[model samples]
Target: MSIVVNLQSKAKPETTTKLISFIEEKLPAVRGFSGCMQVSICLNRDSGDLLFYEKWSSKEAHEKYLLNIQNNGVMAQLMSYLSDPPTVNYYESLDI
Candidate 1:
């Protein structure tokens, strides 16, 4: 089954714009990753929250991507822009 991952990060107000830019720059590579079906970003300027919505072919695929990111230091790079740890949640789609 396809899986959805929501990643939410709280950034320092001063770093929010740079953080968004960094993610935007890296999005194409994310979108091109195997098993990635879609990716979108949301920013709450008032709250300095950055959200990533991603859909993958399967939970295993998403886990592979997570491993790749960790191995490549991408996760560390992203964390450098955040004021606190990110919140990551996974969900399986429910057909109506």
Candidate 2:
């Protein structure tokens, strides 16, 4: 089943611009990874928070890629740039 991951983080207000810029700059590499169906970054309509919406071929595929050496290394670097821990939720398409 196709998997969707929704992630959000609390960031320093000034950092929002930088954060979005960083995500935009780095997303191509992520989307190019194996099994990545689609990826999008958007500002939360209500909270003005950063949101990452990603679709993968499967939950297993997403986990596998996250554990892979290359992506894991990149993830480590990305984590360091955040001001607070991020929240991640996984879901599968039910009707659409």
Candidate 3:
């Protein structure tokens, strides 16, 4: 089953511009990753918070991507742009 991930983070007001640029640079890599169905970035204009919505082929696929990111230090580099820790949640699509 496909999975959806929501990642939320707050950027320091002063770092918002840098944060957006950094994410934009990295998005293509994310979109090209194996098992990545789609990905999007959203900004809360008033709060300057960032929301990442991602769809993956499966939980295992997402976990593999996470491992790859950790191994390549991509996660650490991304976290450096945030003022606070990111909040991540996963959901399985409901067939209803």
lDDT of each: 0.89, 0.75, 0.88
Candidate 3: tens digits of C-alpha lDDT, residues 1-69: 899999899877887888888888888988999999999899886887889999999988888998999
By TM-score, is 1 or 3 better?
1
lDDT, candidate 2, at 12: 56
TM-score of 3: 0.91
Candidate number achieving the greatest lDDT relative to the actual structure: 1
RMSD of 3: 1.2
Model 3 error, position 81 (Å): 1.0
**Considering lDDT, which of the candidate structures 1 and 2 is the better prediction for this target?**
1
Poorest stretch of ten by lDDT in candidate 3: 11-20
Comparing 2 and 3 on TM-score, the stronger one: 3
Residue-level lDDT tens digits of model 2 in 43-86? 75346566789999888877777787355577766565566677
TM-score winner: 1
On the 0 to 100 scale, the lDDT of residue 59 in model 2 is 84
Per-prediction TM-score: 0.92, 0.76, 0.91
Off by over 4 Å in 3: none
